[model samples]
Target: MKRKEYAWAYLFISAPIVGFLLFAFIPLSYSVYVSFTEYSGYQAPVFTGTNNYAKLALHDELFWKTLFNTFYSALSIPIGMVVALGIAMSLNQKVRGIRFFRTMFFLPTISSVIALTLLWKWIFNDSYGLLNYLLELIGIQGPAWLSSETWAMPAMIIQGVWAGLGINMVLYLAALQGVPKSFHEAAEIDGASGWQRFVKITIPCISPTTLYILITSTITALQDFPRFQIMTEGGPNYSTTTIVYYLFQNAFRYMSMGYASAMAWALGLLILAITLLNFWLSKRWVHYE
Candidate 1:
């Protein structure tokens, strides 16, 4: 529009644009360069072409394991989504004490992640763990949750789901609340059952939020590190090591900055590809109102 309006708009947007270029694009470009070299942070990066990726792909068994574990742990996303949606539905009712229950459900999400992770670690301890103790009282045996290769990833997934349930539940609750009651009432007049109303009306109406949560949850799962690191240390046979954890070890613990940068680039590209795939697939399912 007007020149003065343009000037004011530019002034309002300038800081964030400058910040993003300086802090985001510049570092991203630098990391792309670093990924092609062999810099250990103490010395200049020596150009190495695709050796790092080749090494990671063909030679690093732990890399494959970590990659697998990362995807495997992400299995919690769908499970968490179902549970969250169920809880959100229940909370969407106009029942008494609903606000209090909502606050309690959301507390875990806003609480200290470190403290919660430490508590979960203790709860997974083989003998004295609250979980195993309860299982014992029920005449069921519990495996070494963090120590066993078979169970460690599941343990991490459980912690991830428990800690993350509140946020996703809140998201679904918001989406549910946005749905017009008239739609359900109209469907009821047509003799549509509760399940039919939910499936044909509610789901399509909230598909946008569902798609948003699914993509974000998947990306977050790919890069999740804190809970795994604090609770399992990538654990008893590297069974819990994820791609991000592997990248961290190579970057800081082993001091392989360039290699870690390569891993970072790979992870970024993977996330981009998956996100693109989701957006493309969304056209088939996600309906916006």
Candidate 2:
């Protein structure tokens, strides 16, 4: 009977285990190997040792530019966090039609990504776009948002912040609701002002949620690619080109698969370091109780 039970357990897990070895582990191993060679997909890989990495480090000015642009665009993470927290607090209030407001705010998150990207592209159009038209009404001319080098990255950041706010707000709302009402009541009894209660009680209570949001937001920012593809195509002097976009260009456009794999490894290390740093720093402020 025990043998039969063990056989059944293995049967249940076998497919997934095999699938992971084939799809995940094998591909990962090959990618690491490929990073050390020079190859187009159709050609035999020629071993190049550390030349790909050396080129990225010493010769790739475009890679450096893309790295800077990616970090620069990550500014949206903080802006989104602040807006989400504020809206979440408002949504937590005992008010009529709050559910309806929440549903409306969350609508964009449920919409198709391609559709949303195209919609935002139109919204940032130079003359006929809604943003520019609104500016005309106010007697201030709006710049060509996605077409201008200076404004393209910021435009992408705005779209990202708007698109992400609803989900983060929902997470914050859940955290807020989980906070003990007794804490607030006690704070009031101690003559704590509203801001004081928020700072000392609510913020401390919801600290774990904040840390979760921050870490996820950073990871998302690091891998962002769709906005560049749909909104800017990393144009306007490649002002909006990010690391992923640069990787894609190297892999497909230049047929530099080895170079792209090296970039992927580098990006993976960067993300791993940042994630570990977040975890280490979180011990200082992420409250559990």
TM-score of each predicted structure versus truth = 0.94, 0.98
* Candidate 1's TM-score: 0.94
lDDT, candidate 1, 1-289, per-residue tens: 6999999999999999999999999999999999889998999999999999898889988888999999999999999999999999999999999999999999999899899999999999998999999999999999999999999999998988887799999999999999999999999999999999999999999999999999999999999999999988988889999999999999999999888998998889899999999999999999886
Write down the lDDT of every candidate, Cα atoms only: 0.93, 0.94
Measured by TM-score, the strongest candidate is 2
Segments in model 2 whose C-alpha atoms lie over 4 Å from true places: none
Worst 10 residues of 1 by lDDT: 155-164
Model 2, 1-289: lDDT tens digits are 9999999999999999999999999999999999999989989999999999999899999999999999999999999999999999999999899999999888898999899999999999996999999999999989989999989988999999998988999999999999999999998999999999999989999999999999999998999998888899999898999999999999999999999999999999999999999999999988897
Per-residue error at 82 for model 1, in Å? 0.2
Question: Where is model 1 more than 4 Å wrong at Cα?
Answer: 1-15
